[model samples]
Target: MFCYQCEQTDRTNGQPGCASAKGNCGKDATTADLQDLLVHALKGIGQYAALARGLGESDREADRFILFGLFTTLTNVNFDAARFTAFLREAATTRNRVKARCDELAQARGTTIQPLSDAAAWQPGASLPELLAQASTVGIQEGLKKLGEDVIGLRALVLYGLKGVAAYAHHARVLGYESEEVYAGVETTLDFLARHPTDVNALLSHALELGQLNLKVMELLDAANTGRFGIPQPTSVRMTPVAGKAILVSGHDLGDLHALLEATKGTGVQVYTHGEMLPAHGYPTLKAYEHLAGNYGGAWQEQHSDFAKFPGPILMTSNCIIEPLPLYRQRIFTTGPVGWPGVRHLADHDFTTLIQAAKALPGFRETASDESITVGFGHDAVLGVAGKVVDAVKAGKIRHFFLIGGCDGAAPGRNYYTEFAQQAPDDTVVMTLGCNKYRFNRHQFGDIEGIPRLLDLGQCNDSYSAIRIATALATAFGCGVNDLPLSLVISWFEQKAAAVLLTLLALGIRNIRLGPTLPAFLTPNALDILVKQFGIQPLGDARTDLAMALAPRAA
Candidate 1:
């Protein structure tokens, strides 16, 4: 197995599923085997949901379990060997219960079928090659139209979207909010993927369903965010690391950032935001912490180099972790679902260890001589200026709105985003979210009537903010959302971006230019359906794309 689709691949042009026989990071054969088993177990859990549906027993716990389990398997989230094994055991138990119930139903109907739960019963000592051979014969990868690949790819994208939903739902759960529909979507999607073969129409329907489900998930998260932290206000966050002690927290979890800020309070330890944490500066409750220092790095993909320059400890509260560089390895810690085998792991919302580590690390040395870039243009802030924005548009002061935001990574062509931002028309306003915003965060695009060229709207999860702003803009203008003079040029690198994209589609927004190469997981047919149905086009050259985006739309 060989995999290297992420930014921190040890080897260039590596595989996505597995990077070498035993992942390049010395994951070893045993770990690889367990990871596969864990995936299969989760698949089993999803299959069980169908049985539950049959018995009319759908509930919150089952829904949460499926979403959380799939999200945990996503890259860079969970790497703790022991914790994963325990999760697999739990999955096995759930699988057994599902099988038992199915068997009882079958017996009552005077029908007999093999129990899906018993992994050993299916095939005794069957070689992997034999299973692969049989599966290959019936698999959806061989055809003139490549229908199998297309269907598989569509399902894969939907599964990835579910993973993103789980991540956000889990975050909301941590913040004391839960959505039953989001969880049900997870179970339903899983059941569909586990049992069905590649079918073009079926996959297309699922993709759209994914879009619909993600919209609800984002709304649930948006409610949780605004309820906990007051609506975001426009504010500038310092780009320089503070002098003396500090802890740089990176991840999409605002709750975790708040908790860490609280834990480090009065400890003389300055708190610095990194990656997704940059948005914390915009939140009323979070920014109130005077000790919260400026942002420490550029983006998630740069952690290998950027983290090395950090003068203090770094706590990763979520995804986008690429194996830490040696210089920062000792000072790096992970909490929540994120983990590195030997790295210090904090469990069960316990950030005390993180606080202690920050104290033990070398004090943060002042790095910034002056202010660099300003962030924090969340939904509320944008809405506050909605009238001015509408007037500017009507008055021909702002020509276009470019939402050049999504995930960022070390992919070669990703520089296209920076070039695009640099080349966007002077009369345009750029809105960004997630680490993708880093590309042009410092790029001077000048200003339009006191508003900066680029507006940062927080993290990947805050894509909801952008959606809200878009909808509000449409409402203010009394026109359909797609009728607004706004365009989205998004770059996706992970599951969270997938969820956000689905939400945009659910809202019936169209003509989105997405790039840095389409996901390797997307099949050709699925791509075609997207183009035909939603007018989703891939980005070309920076100049060409920018020109096309700024040009007048067809009547």
Candidate 2:
């Protein structure tokens, strides 16, 4: 059909008539159409939020819709067709409200607008095959361009970051902690994004603004996490499978990690973190569980190979799910939006399936005993050593802080992240999360003042740690976040990475370098805007880039 969400596209590859085989990322015809509809609905809901704002409407429904819709669009989060259709129905309803409000705004302003007045336009009917056909006929390339890929891409980026935030927000909300301002940003930004036209300059401004909002979101989450679970501290998690049956938990879900830890309290099964889930070990509450074992695998992309080798059940809590190999397919259980048709899914955070599956799967034999790796360097933990850090800085013992973190992928060029982390000077500190951290987490980068140069800060979702550390450093230096001598060299693989990058941008943290390649989804115009307005740059060679990053800026 007609869909071009990834950087690789048939239209751009000299295959104008051929609708398939353009993107190397493995999404097919149906997946593409579903994604488009989801995006369209998200935009519609965003438009509605803007309308409600004009009327000074304070509706929680609008906020939830924006948050859920955006979260659903994130990569590897939601793959179930039935769930997507349900979301489409809800979004259509929200879209109508947005269009109606948009029309009202136009009328009040004495300007004519194309009123997306028909609520029924988005309503689904029995013509399922026909609709799919229609979508196929709809020029995918043309529609994406019309939608302003750059603007749409960037907005999607912001929404994705919020999704990561929402993941944390959801946990905090359940724990009786909520950030009203974050809720407001999630609503207002989505609404604004839905109706607003894509202007490079405007998006550049909004991108940074999004960062500012995300800073607040991260703060709210940090407070929630620390307040509920106690401040994070340095923790060393093992990397080997434990004796008896075990369940491997992946993604960024502390509550689930805690739940699993609680459920397995007396059970013989052990638990380990995989991918982004590795950071759960840093939390004081969760780490205290004796059954919580060490990390099993690397980032999400390696699942095809990594999951296959595991001797027990594996739980996928969120994104970065690759098609499971047949060997380990039965042992794989997914929760949250991560789903595959035949795999067991635990709805509503229910661990019945997880616990049962852990028991049923052939119990794992202890491969490594009591071995561990250090984790849990949130702002608090880092700050605990802030005096030493500052002293090191003053003594020229710690020269730089390289935040080498983001999503991991199978792309050949992806090795750059590992190379970059490896090449980082011994006097520097490497803060990382997400799968990208896997590149150099195991590498021996030497140490500065008893601290390893490469410090694992949990998962990609733990990018919050990087943000917190930056803000704290800035506070200590009595300057803004940008004024700190911190450099963020990020690698992006999916929408979540996109969102994290936007959060960085939203915070006005500029002069950052991103790679292996910019999202194919972004148009040149959008790229230009980011480069000129935000001073954002793409990555060069690791050594060269490191030199540029470490070089003192002009006064």
Candidate 3:
């Protein structure tokens, strides 16, 4: 039941992970075991799926199942052990379907199927205890004694990176975007894991390759979102509540938020974006709905207090859901890959139940004073004023750029990001995305000339925007991205940040600072490899890091 997949995982007694009855994220040992088993089952599906794809046979359903299944195992995404049990059974069924298809294709091609690993042939147990027993054999620690920490750590890196990729890919997939290459990449990586190769270099190489795959997935997602909702534009969103029946939409699914917005159009229910959904306000199509109020609360880590205080039904469209407090437990609903054992789940984007609950609950009885935040400074919006930005840089009006954001958590060390952003020199501009920006977004950074000093590039899902802006700026400057006067100060809480980090590394970006803590799964040897190869650094004092980033040598 040991798990250290997120930044918030307990390290009491110098333990490597949360091995107690309940993890720091509130996921119990049983749920953790079930998630591990589900991953093992997905590896089986991947083995068969990869084989099938190689044989000129493809199962789209099986491929999608792999993505969604892996996404569910991400930190704080799904904590329902029963849901994982069902997923295990479904994984076996999906694997069998792909296996049958592969066999048929091989027979038709007059080619014999190759022998497979235990994951490819394994079956799930009928009961929870039996499944837990099976899971024990496949846990991440299973090979530690023989393979050692370095190999296991690298494997964990690949696996966690894949989970992040799957989460992003799944979001794009829901909006009718599909990439066969991305699917193949995922299946191939999973198949690689199934074989349990111990070569450190090979594992590291595969992880970088996963990062490239994630870049592709992120591109597809960007297209899916922008194509559906139009490119995000600079828009001001209200931070204060308006009087009405309200439904607070959280997580990162724009499609779900759109559906709920459409459903409650004339029902007097105001849909407020929460957490990662805060960026939705910048999308033209989503914002077109007058009833789509504005963002509520802050990041995922504050949901307990935020949700309890919010006077409306809350819908979590994706990951970063916590154990719901009783105050709002009945009013909180889940969709997509997010789950809590007793929480009501809305499937197929049906918002009727959610809308009804919003009506029944007491929404904001009176309007709060008007306050707002600016968002939608995505690549399109920012690059639209490329001339001014480049001119400012050349004129020395803007001295540096800081990309400070990632998944935020309640860790006290997270205060470093807030201070880092706050302490940034007046001549420097800060561009942020993900929920982490909540720390300093409210602060008045003003702007360099006409360009805002703090640019909100939307959700972690909008990481592609950050990459795009960086590459574009690099192009304009006639230099490599790293050579540009920009620094990435990231605070990661979960797997999505892992994927984003891999993408940055794969792109040969270096000297990025990552905190609040290094991943527990990364042995010192593995950390050393990353530092030596990519110049990845553990974050230090915000002021010191900022000074270093601005030093003449850095440029």
- Computed on alpha carbons, the lDDT of every model, listed in order, comes to 0.73, 0.68, 0.91
TM-score, predicted candidate 3 vs. hidden true structure = 0.99
Q: What TM-score do all the candidates reach, one by one?
A: 0.88, 0.86, 0.99
Q: Which ranges of candidate 3 are over 4 A from the true structure?
A: none
**Tens-digit lDDT track of model 2 for 103-173:** 67767878775453222245543455644553443334543567656666555445555555555555455
Cα displacement (Å) at residue 433, model 2: 2.3
Per TM-score, what order, best first?
Answer: 3, 1, 2
Of the candidates shown, which would achieve the greatest lDDT relative to the real structure? 3
Give the RMSD in angstroms, all C-alphas superposed, for model 2. 4.2
| Candidate with better lDDT, 1 vs 3 | 3
Off by over 4 Å in 2: 1-26, 49-62, 90-121, 130-140, 144-177, 196-198, 478-483, 552-555
TM-score of 1: 0.88
Best model per TM-score = 3
Q: Residue 259 error for model 2, in Å?
A: 1.7
Global CA lDDT computed for model 2: 0.68
* TM-score, cand. 2 vs. native: 0.86
